[model samples]
Target: MFYQAKSTCLYCDHKFTTTKVRMSKTKVLKRDSDFCIHYDGPNPLFYDITICPECGFAFYNSYRKLSDHQRKKLKEAYISKINVMNMVGERTIEEAIHTFKLALLTASIVNERKFITANLSLKLAWLYRMIEDEAEELRFLQNALDDYIYMMAYEDIEQEEVDEDRLIYLIADLNLRLGHYVDARRLFSQLITGKQVSPRYKSLAIDRWQDYKEELEDGD
Candidate 1:
């Protein structure tokens, strides 16, 4: 179910082939509260980013084009510094992680939106979680939390990307994971009280809030 598809890099206009997974071949094992999917076969998450072999450019759906300034910086920082190697065919988990790391590095160099970086960090966390790498998972989780917080404060999240209810729920969930109990409680409270929040998120927020309170009581 894995195959290669032609991709043209926006940064360098260099055409290349990238591996992709056919979703029909994969069964969904489960999904996390944050909507991270666990698959029974080759995970599609591994093949999300498109990396250009010729210029060492890496990107995904979030970033399709780059400004002149961003292109110049990416060329100097990434294209000029790294040894461009052609990566084709199927990829192992380690190789997939490496590709994601390259994408993260490129996103940083190009000053991509916080939403993009946050999603990348979250994906890294999910990838590490799949391998049971707790340390790396937590590290990327913290990065994702920080980026999401920044996004909430300074960035406008389009409804199509992340609706208001999902955004609040995500913030609450991140705070819960990070042990920011007060923040989690606050956001969860808001989510539960919000009229526009869906029943799914409201129920989740209610359950998590109760769990947090119970944990605090047990600790005391």
Candidate 2:
């Protein structure tokens, strides 16, 4: 989905609020149309692209299927972004964090929005937890869990089973980090029950589960 854009000033690079855009289309009752992605349109389909009124940052909200070439390009883009993230030191950590999130936003649009969103949100949640931002961490962890669920829903088509399982484990880990012991235990239990999940992952889950049990027993 390309739309859902934040406006920006091209000259000053200041971002603004987001606004909705509409699409109009025509359909025939009986016949199939070649122009429609969903085959619901009979003839010409007009679509709206969400655009920034200020800087002309137009994005079309779409769910594009990933091709192998696109995946490779995405990997390259991600690596480059990580390299860029690492370039900043202690002085620029805040800017680095913003850049990292923006890069993740772009990654979310690249055919695997659900997975990217889950991963990004979880990472941010962990970071927030580290900074003692309990409310923010909880919110982001929930976002991560929701996105992970969405990603899991498409596991069959996208070979996302392993990733989904991993995300579950991550969610459990984060929950534990945030002192949500019951939630972490339940999530870890669910993750460990997945026979299709890798042995390594299952082992990790078991280890975490034991640790969690101990923590609960220790009354902290």
Candidate 3:
């Protein structure tokens, strides 16, 4: 289910082979409400972030190409400090978490887009959920929620492939998971009643809102 792929480091231009999961070989078991996929075998999410053995620059496909100034800054601020680890081959869940954390750090150091950082945080949260680490999961979920909210407020959604309505629903769901019930309820209501929202996400918001209400009633 894994194959070696060649990658060039964005900062150092080091060509290296890295392992990736073949999605065709994996079967989808189910997805959580937050859209984390469960697989029958090795999870592909573990291999999504590629880490450079030379410069320690970790990134994914959606990452923007580094400018010359950004590269210089990365070298001075990050590359000079850390010991580069070889994360080239097959990875365990813990190893994946390490690479993801490295990618998040890289994103921050270079001022990567909020959308990309939000995705990295969300995936990191999902990895923590797989390990039943509730504390870490909620922590990253909050990071994702904050980034997504920032993106919605100041960034251009048209530039990215992300659907705005779905993003709103995700923000609302993250609020729910983080125990921010008032914000969750208000955002979910916005999606449920918005005239311009897509039917698919609207339906999803309604379903999740109903589930939350039912859970509250059952608890009482």
Question: How accurate locally is residue 6 in candidate 2, as Cα lDDT from 0 to 100?
Answer: 52
Off by over 4 Å in 2: 1-91, 104-112, 155-164, 175-183, 190-196
lDDT of 1 by residue, 1-220 (tens): 8877888888878877788898888899998866789988888898888878777777876784899999889878888898775566677788788878998999998888898899899998889998999899889989999998899888878833687688788878877887787898789988889888899889988987887779889999
Better of 2 and 3 by TM-score: 3
Q: Is candidate 1 or candidate 3 better by lDDT?
A: 3
- Candidate 1 — which residues are off by over 4 angstroms? 210-220
Output the number of the lDDT-best candidate.
3
Candidate 3's error at 99, in angstroms? Answer: 0.5
Best first by lDDT, ranked = 3, 1, 2
Count of backbone clashes, every candidate in sequence: 0, 9, 0
Residue pairs of candidate 1 with colliding backbone atoms: none
Residues 1-220, candidate 3: write the lDDT tens digits: 8999999988888999999998889999998878999998999999999999887888987888899989888888889998888898888999999999999999998999999999999999999999999999999999999999999989988899788888999999999999999999999999999999999999999999999999999999
The whole-model C-alpha lDDT of candidate 3 against the native structure comes to: 0.93
